[model samples]
Target: MIESPGILYSIGAFLLVIGPLVFVHEMGHYLVARWFGTKVEKFSIGFGREIAGWTDKRGTRWKIGWMPLGGYVQFAGDLNAASQPDPNAGDASAEERAALFQFKPVGQRFLIILAGPMINFLFAIILFMGIFATYGQAQNAPVVSAIMEGSVADQAGFELGDEISAVDGRAIDRFDELADIVRLRPGQQMQFDILRDGRELSITAVTADVTVEDRFGNEARIGRLGVQSAVLEMETLGALQLPGAALTQTLSSLEMITVGLGQIISGRRSIEELGGPLRIAQFSGQTASLGLYAFLFFMAAISINLGFINLLPIPMLDGGHLVFYAAEAIRRRPIKPEAQEWAFRMGLAVLLSFMLMVTVIDLGSFGLWERLSGLIS
Candidate 1:
């Protein structure tokens, strides 16, 4: 669907964005396992046949696989890359058994499994902090500068110079936060609390759904309340203040995503907008074209999404592993191997089906089928 230079550009951008994130995630697991005295058998970046690799002094086979979609770290005593304990690990030499991942205390095992996602979150925080410290944040107070004539804001009696205090009971400090909330709930009623003339008043209005096209020609419908901010302000974070600002910004993004997901689940938004690798590649290339700051912000966002997705309680994922560990903790033993295998199979099936659906959506978005039809004619 993507042709020539565009295809090559997308591939390069995708690799650059995903490779470092995957490496950071696996490194978290590898480092924590080593800390718990477990031997890592392999540290891999990607899957399938090895393209290139070398052994470390610690005897771990570090390799890059042909498929660059995802990666894993295999621990000694694991049957495969999924970290299933080797059935014969029990019969291993006492010395070898000492370094077996399964032999570790449950707490240490839990920590090792958790370290991967935790590191992803930490990486996002660091990236955000660095960006904020370097470039600072561009912000604007949520003060109404103008009310669109005969629009929702005008109908709701929104006046110029009114500072927004809250939306739907959620306190908003900046104009962007107000925009974020309003954009997701098109045609829905919203309650706005504003401070005007030193008096606070609440106004209720229904948002207007506006269809917009992005630079990539993707169409999306978002809500607009028709009130503009009075003035834009650039707020610079001091070195000492960077951490707090970064954390706040990162958490806000996460919360916004969570709310967006909820809206989709509630049928307030279209699930057809769900995307897969193709969509991700498109975004990667587009962001890279916007220069370094934009690319770094995009990477931070992807890292946060990765961390959150990995924390979902689906088997074959980090969260699923955590669930098993939790069960083992309560029962004083691991779940039956047969049961674990079945859970993983189901999880794999669900993931694959979702991937296929999103891939189809991506192709449709790219007009791949339409182009092929035109060629046939």
Candidate 2:
């Protein structure tokens, strides 16, 4: 079992992992806005009161805020960090109009908002590229070495030394790929293509729904086939192959994330499984203690998640702004300021409520509720 390194260590590790990522995300917006000749009023790395700050030569206030949850880049014509367009944006002087974000073309505005999430995906790819280039990629052949008695695989007629060629017509080259497909598909019937004694055969099975606990005592419900593969192989990647490998890995990670989110939305996964900032800190601390490679891998995974979450089409998010721009492009007119304001308010409410729910879940996962009940009793 893995033990947490205490609260202080977790907080420090969370900041170290999240700070650079937040900077990278905001930088994408800052650079893209500058490229479009828009004036950035502030580039803060966190929210709430500023802990420290300085003005750049270009008149941008670069500051670090007390709250390290997230950051924002506020443009000159923005009402706030959420980038709600100012109602009086058109009242700017002739010179100021050129530097205001609200005055930019709809296409430019879409791209500026898109850049933040896109850069995050790009950053994850770069990190994966470095990792693959340095340590190579490990692959476990999808050949079964053992099967549990009366398990799903055994009940499905799986035999020792049987090679899994495909699942549900999707080709599988690695054991982990098969595991991923199964994990996300609890209680679903799946067709497995098998190569046994040089003959191709098909078998079907209903995956077993199993609840497993991580070393840190977090429990997750997933599909299990009750098969094992011990034959491991490492493929050395060269400079020419790094990009392709990295892109493939990134896409695979994205697929897993999307599937997990789909499960949660479909009620196949519990909402209590959702984690917030506190859980992130716990993971950051745990991964940091594992080693540099472990920490970097966790960072890359979180970066992709951050990018994906921001692209969700909810108001007050980058995707929401892109949606507005799309409407403006089609209608040849901007969305009404009043309508956008109401949408932002609704979005803020939804976002905060979601945060609170996840925070409560995090506290419960830490046994806070159990301890409180004990005290009261």
Candidate 3:
């Protein structure tokens, strides 16, 4: 059973993960709208009550909210549900009512909508780079520490303390090469050349099948030869290595997101794997158990997920708004007010349903219901 996380760490983790992501996302809209001469009504992080706020020079209300789930930037003339439609929008008859969001040009609206997700992507990239700057890449060098008896190496008659000199007759300069060579070819026989006590010994070993479960609970059939390599020598980044590390980290995350999407579509993953708020809290607690660095790493991963998910072209999302903007640009007109309102309603329903479904999965995944069932039974 998973233990509950420390309250302070859990709260800190939530703030760390959500705050910057929302800030960047909202800032994207705020900056773009400003550039286009659009008046932003308010910039808010979270919902419900306001915690801290100030009217900016532009008269935009900058606020931190009590609820930390997500945020929004309300542009003037945003008389609709931000992206929804309202025929009565920005119509000032009797008193003071300047242009709200609806009055913005198609080009300006395009940039405003695009800004939110772009900022998220940029934030992820920066985080990845920051992580890399702190921890340099793993440098692989072959070092044999110990071998388990009755394992693959043992069955193959390979001796302990044998330095892997080559794999499949290929010369191995570094220890890391063995992992990919082994992992990619499951249930296949492989040749190994090891430096056993300074004597070259060649042997054949059959790779084993391993099941890998990712954070999303998607399992993969992987190849394993049951060989353990000594941990790579830790690295300390010099001045020149920081930028490279960050770039690599960001690219790696993007690749991972691609792989995840493909797997979901290919029937290799379950839709139940999608996680909502519950899972974030679960991960927060789990990471807190591993200490500060681990928690921060988890925070980075969640930030990336938030960024990517927001970019999906779903209605009620930043991406969805961008889609509408594109349509408006092509048609040279706003989507009809009624059409936009109906679209918002549809989008809202779909998003809410998805959230509810994922929350159920999250609760079950965490075993909270399981524990309760056991207690009841």
Candidate 4:
């Protein structure tokens, strides 16, 4: 095992991953707003005092801020960097109003707000597709390498070297597909079609519920078939197939995350699995040590996460803006500024509280306090 780097190393790694992501996400909004002819005043990376900047030919002040946590784009009619509409935006000249964000059509505004998350998803898909195109897809077939003694597979007569062809009449070509099918169906009976000794046979067995700790160290009960994969192999995909494969993998990963979250909400999974920036930073360094390909894969996964999180309907987020736009569309007018202010304040509180909770968990996971106490002793 590699020795753990100090806290400074983790902080630096965290910045490297988040900096580009924040830039890309904010740029998505900036570019789309420009396309819609809205006047962008300032495009700043980070939230505090300007560290360095240059005004573009288009009259946009692009700058880096002292704080590197998050960023914003200030539009002509914005009340602040948060993109709230200016109170006097409606009273501007026709030409000025035409170039203002708030004066733009609702459809234009919606597209501009939606572009951020969409770009994140698109960026991940393109990255994955490129990676796959360069290096072949690592394939692991649904072939069993072992059956635990006295377990469901052993009781059902499953043997080593048996290849699973289908489950409950559904064809599965990949090991992950088979595993996923079983993992979500604990206590349920399944009909399996397998090829053993060059002969196809059918077997039925009830899945076994196994309590296991997830990657984040949260315990959850999932189904286990008492089977393991033989080995991992790589399958090359043609140029034409790369996009399709990349998209399929992206959707599958997203679906798994959605289901996992649903389980947590439904009391099937533990909420302790919810991690903060520290967990991400720790994993980032670990993954970087693996190889460039592994690191890129981590980036893609994080990109998808960023996209999904921003699309959630919480105040002070991109999704929150979309929600406001939807309300405006339905009511045939913008929401009152007083109400929007309160909502943003509440959203900020919720996000801060969540960050604090996860940070505490991260410290515990890292054994920070334990190590400190040992030093004191």
Candidate 5:
């Protein structure tokens, strides 16, 4: 029997992770719609034909789709409920068509658009805080662990066991904080305060220009001060520790998204850096192997990504609708329907193109074609 590509296994793994994550995202929109006195028509866990579902007393149909790409929420009084174009709209009566998104008041529409992303952010915070409150956070004491051969850290005369006290006079307590400052430049020189033996030590590390590939096959020559943390010394925290930890995680997530976007836009990174479902499964399986702690962390990161992607100001996206609503609020009138329609079309095209590109990368990353071609070759 031919090997299954571990396809089913990966799919199961991804569904375990993404199904709940996407539900949380869509629920953010759904709950908000209800809060605003709008009726929800459907709450789907996946898209396409409904394999399993039910209608609640509230008259909402909850179903799972055949294609498990992602989930969505459909508000009431709308044909198909999403931004997708519907040929069925042509046959609708004038009153039916009148209930279209474009006909909604700008203020009402703004809340609906804003809710999806807002819920994502809220979920991230809650997850982070929950994790912290339950298990606590462990951090290293800003000590250098390993120095990569020929890396910037090695060349900067950074010896192992040098306890980094600060970066640019900012007292550094965590390795993440140090990484944030270090990765900010590829060739920039920064001051480092270290505690060596018992005395304070002052040093400078010139970030070397080096290229690294991200999760997606994007190349970036970044300032490489290649250093590893000594170890994760377990430091348990009290219940009050959750909020702070949540804030820290939030800032870190924001920094990552900002840096990734900047690198992609600046040509320092390539578009091939994007990965879709397949990649998630690969990582998810790996994370599952590492056990619960790592899996939770991975899920949290993915949650942050979901939030960030939704917040981007693109048509058909939560952010895109918010932009239009903002414009309407300022001008005291809705945007021309044609403009909204055109923007939605363009956004859909861009999103699909990106999805296809990511799928390609996923296939390559998994070496599907390469292995097959090698057999033929």
Candidate 6:
């Protein structure tokens, strides 16, 4: 049986991981709004009723909410956390009207909305920079040290010493890159460029689709290459190289997220693979148990995901707001309030439904469904 972290530890780790991320994300919006001379009414670390809070000198209420799922920043002249323009926004006095976010120029408003996700990405890069500056980067050559017997690689005529040079025309410099490419293309046929005994050759193989369960009982489906690296190496980077390296790592992570999302949308991957707060908590606990470095790495990856997800063009997201601003910039006027309100309502419903679906998936990952079935039977 796989051992799991205690409930208390998981909850604590979850908060440690999430609290700062949410703060950073919301702070992005707050700072940008303030820079544009807009008033930020509230900065919250989560949704729902306030657990503890204090009003700042600027009259912004800083608070922690009971629900730890997500957070928002409420600005002046906004209907709520979604930042919808207030119907009474035009009724404000001159002094208050000047500070209202709704009255800001389209360019300023776009930046204010864009800042949140941009900051998340920046935060992830910073975390990665720290990690590289301290522990360096872990990597291995793309040489096939071993291939599983009768597996896809083996059937594709992969030799033990064959070195992978590329995958489908994309250059592969490291084992991790090759692994990442294969992992995202489960059950799909891929062309591989390899060097076998100093001779260049190409091989085609279909990656095996496999379901893997972590110690915490959370499951994920990934493509398996059935090959191993002979040696793992850590390359230390100088201070000057750290930033670039970190940015590359962040972009690589962002690419993986986008690919996974595309697969889900295209029906190539299962919606059951989507995770919610429960899975995040479990992952937090598991990574924390591994060590500080492990936890930080996990945090950075999740931060990237948070940034990317918010940039989706779906309503109620940062991307959706940007879309509105884009239209305003072109048309030389704001979209109709009635139309905006309807879009927001639709967006809220989509978001709520998504949350519910992921929550159900999270519960199933914990064997809730199996236990319930057994009980019923």
Question: Relative to the true structure, how large is the alpha-carbon lDDT of every model?
Answer: 0.88, 0.91, 0.72, 0.84, 0.76, 0.91
Q: Give candidate 1 misplaced runs (Cα > 4 Å).
A: 1-5, 372-377
Point out the higher-scoring one by TM-score: 2 or 6.
Answer: 2
Order of quality (TM-score): 2, 6, 1, 4, 5, 3
Q: Is candidate 3 or candidate 6 better by lDDT?
A: 6
The top-ranked prediction according to TM-score is: 2
**Pairs with backbone N, CA or C atoms under 3 Å apart (clashes), candidate 5:** 186-223, 216-273
Q: Write the per-residue lDDT of candidate 4 for residues 252-271, one digit (tens) a residue.
A: 66876787788778876667
RMSD to the true structure for each prediction, in A, is: 2.4, 1.4, 6.2, 3.6, 4.8, 1.6
- Give candidate 6 misplaced runs (Cα > 4 Å): 215-217
Off by over 4 Å in 2: none
Q: Global CA lDDT of candidate 1, please?
A: 0.88
Q: How do the residues 1-377 of candidate 3 rate in per-residue lDDT, one tens digit apiece?
A: 44566657667767777788788888988888777777777889998789999997879898988989899888665653355644566455433333455666777777778878777767766665565556545566665565666667768776657778888877765565677567655666889887877788788888876678755444556567766667666566676766666565665566566665675677655666567786676567667776666766676677677767777777788778788889988998877777767777888898889878888887887788899999999
Quote the lDDT for 200 in model 6.
96
Q: What is the overall TM-score of model 3 with all chains considered together?
A: 0.74
Residue ranges of candidate 4 with Cα displaced over 4 Å: 5-9, 160-171, 180-224, 369-377
Q: Could you tell which candidate, 2 or 3, scores higher by lDDT? A: 2
* Candidate 4 to truth, TM: 0.86
Query: Candidate 6 lDDT (Cα, whole model)?
Result: 0.91
- Per-prediction TM-score, please? 0.94, 0.96, 0.74, 0.86, 0.82, 0.95
- lDDT (10s digit) by residue, model 2, range 1-377: 87868889999999999999999999999999999999999999989999999999999999999999999999999999999988888888989999999999889889999999999999999998888777667788999999999899988899999999999999988898899889888898999999999999999999999999988776888999989988667677888988887887788889989988888999988888789999999999999988888888899999999999999989998988989999999999999988999999999998999999999999998899999999999
Q: Which structure among the candidates has the greatest lDDT?
A: 2
Instruction: Report how far residue 76 has shifted in candidate 5, in Å.
Output: 2.7
